[model samples]
Target: MLTKKKVIISIAVLVVLMTGVMLLGNQEGAAEAENKQVTIEAVNNKVYVMVQQVNFIEKAAEIEFKASLEASEEGIVSSKVGGKVVQILFEEGEYIHQGEPLVKLEEKEAGNNLRAAESQLSAAQASLTSAEVNLESEQGNFERLKVLFDHNGIAKVELEKAEIAVKVAKANVEALKANVLTAQVNVESLTDSLAYTTISAPISGMMDEKSVSLGQNVDSGTILGKVKNISPINAVIEVKQTNLEDIKVGQKAKVTIGEREPLVYEGTLKSINGSADPSSRVFKGKIQLDNPDQALKPGSFAKAEIVNDQKVEIATVPLAALAGNEDSCYVYVNDQGIARKRSVIIGETEENVVVIKSGVQKGESVICTNVTTLQDGDVIEVVAE
Candidate 1:
């Protein structure tokens, strides 16, 4: 049989053990409750963000655009008149001015024609002189007959015949004069045709194409070559129709070519095509860029932007700060060391920054990045950089 004192001692030790177990369970429960608390950010939290001032106005705003560079004036040159090309004055890729002669036509035939016309004119002049001499002789005869008739030494009928002869000779001289005038006019026409044998440039530019070679026979109005003008380059850009509302005249643009240093240019929205591209639903706009060096050429791809009408100068935050879609933008702003989820009104949105219209004020810290992993009213320890 066990002693009664030993049984009582065992019961006391069991009660002490149970009390210690209860104490440990209570402490563990308290620690778990503290661990459930979320860690978040406050205004004092340090994070690097790119920031820009914005303009909050009653009307519109300015939106930045990215695009490439292009030239406006580009074309091919062609010939106006044609003949056997005797000489090409300019080499391929030579700069030429307006009215500069490009090719010389073989003027052998034209020269022969001119010479023939000149010979005909000379012959006409000789004929005119002969006709004048004949008229003078006939007039002298008529005058002598008149004298004879006055003295009654000649018959009236004979004097009348002499006078008729004089009149006929004078008419012949006048007809010969007309023929000389006609011959002179023919000479001038031939001379002009001879001048047209040489082909010239219509505009000042660099010769791009030279299709005719020496001794090549070409007809009138045949295309001989091309000249390209590369100055005051124009950039053609297509913008989304929805984005057109933000674009207007006299906007500044920055253009970049592939691997080329970016160029800062100013442009006046020269034209806006009313019709949208049928497949792309994009509208077309043109920007004129000054390219005095003739570096920009045609058929180059480019992009452009029209600075928004309104100047912007308001509080702005990083794009990561904004919550929800574009329609309902919100952010978690830090106020007095507490993270508060707030609804925000947005204005213009740039690449990485957004214009805050309302719901957030200047100098307020907002949770900019990693918003999806955050909760409302989270307690966060501010980490310093």
Candidate 2:
């Protein structure tokens, strides 16, 4: 009976030990599965991306706007006298200089009047010379008569008559002199009238709008043509009130024209309007460009980039790092290995880089690659470039 009781106790103890071992194994398996699941989740959540530190650079701020090219100077061509246009000296679209003759009118009537005045002046001068000679003879006669009267050789009446004759001769000579002077003035008037028959350019520039033709009649102050000085042309731009503070007179600017293989010209901000426009609330500005080649034409579309003289320190990032359109720009910045979406104010773009006006600090790591795939509070693994 004692042997049988001991065998039953031994089996019970072995069964209890086996149950404990099985329970421990099951617990270990569950722990391992939980750990594996956690590892998978961590791997799935982490994103691998390339990043670059934001750089602060000191550079001049630039503002760009669409502009129109215009002539710096313009002149209206007109005539001062009225006559029939006998000749047109220049054609439309011709380049002319100031005071260069452009048209000619009939001057036959003026020439005839001038010749008649000249003939009158010659006759008056001849009559004046004859009158002066007669006055000298009359004076001699009066002196001789006075000497005879002093010696009782001639009467006082004879002396008085001689004096009267001298006075008459002097009056005649004075009248002839007056007539000569009037004739001379008439000649000058006719000469000026003849000169007015020719019309000339008022300014040196490209001429256009030839209104008068050969045999066409024109009156004084008639619109003949227009001359526009295109060299050193002006690029007119409208600037908002907010931007006007940054721009100043004599600031450097760059102008671009055309699209396919565009042409660039360097210029300066020549002027700005004192007040803004009532309707648009913008100020008009002018950028003067030296166009010696005449490559830029007036009324052509252009773009002006004004560079401010003040240099500012600005944060910059790669173009790829930026997301969203120009209206609302944002970037993904890495904060302690986590991607944080940050909204930023966009500015001018340089080569392969963009200026960040706000929302990012210098030396902060910005995710450049895989930015679109990132979300706020995402775990990121920064990779080398």
Q: What is the C-alpha RMSD of each candidate to the true structure, in Å?
A: 8.0, 9.1
Candidate 1 residue spans exceeding 4 A from truth: 1-82, 91-93, 228-261, 267-289, 304-385
Q: Judge candidate 2 at residue 141 and give its lDDT.
A: 92
Per-residue alpha-carbon lDDT of candidate 2 for residues 1-385, written as tens digits (9 for 90 to 100): 8999999999999999999999999999999999999999987878999999999988787888999998899999887778888988898877889999988989987788889899999999999999999999999999999999999998889999999999999999999999989988998888887998887888888887667788888887889888889888899999998897788999999898886567788999999999889998999999999988777788899889999877878888999999987578899999988999999997656689988889999778899988877889999888764
Clashes found in each candidate (C-alpha, N, C closer than 3 A): 11, 0
Instruction: Find the number of clashing residue pairs for candidate 2.
Output: 0
Minimal lDDT window, size 10, model 1: 47-56
Q: After superposing candidate 2, which stretches have Cα over 4 Å from the reference?
A: 1-56, 61-70, 143-153, 235-264, 269-287, 301-310, 313-383
Give the winner by lDDT: 2
Sequence-dependent TM-score of model 1: 0.57
lDDT of 1 by residue, 194-289 (tens): 887877787777676678778888887777787766566666777787787777656665454443444445666677788899997877777777
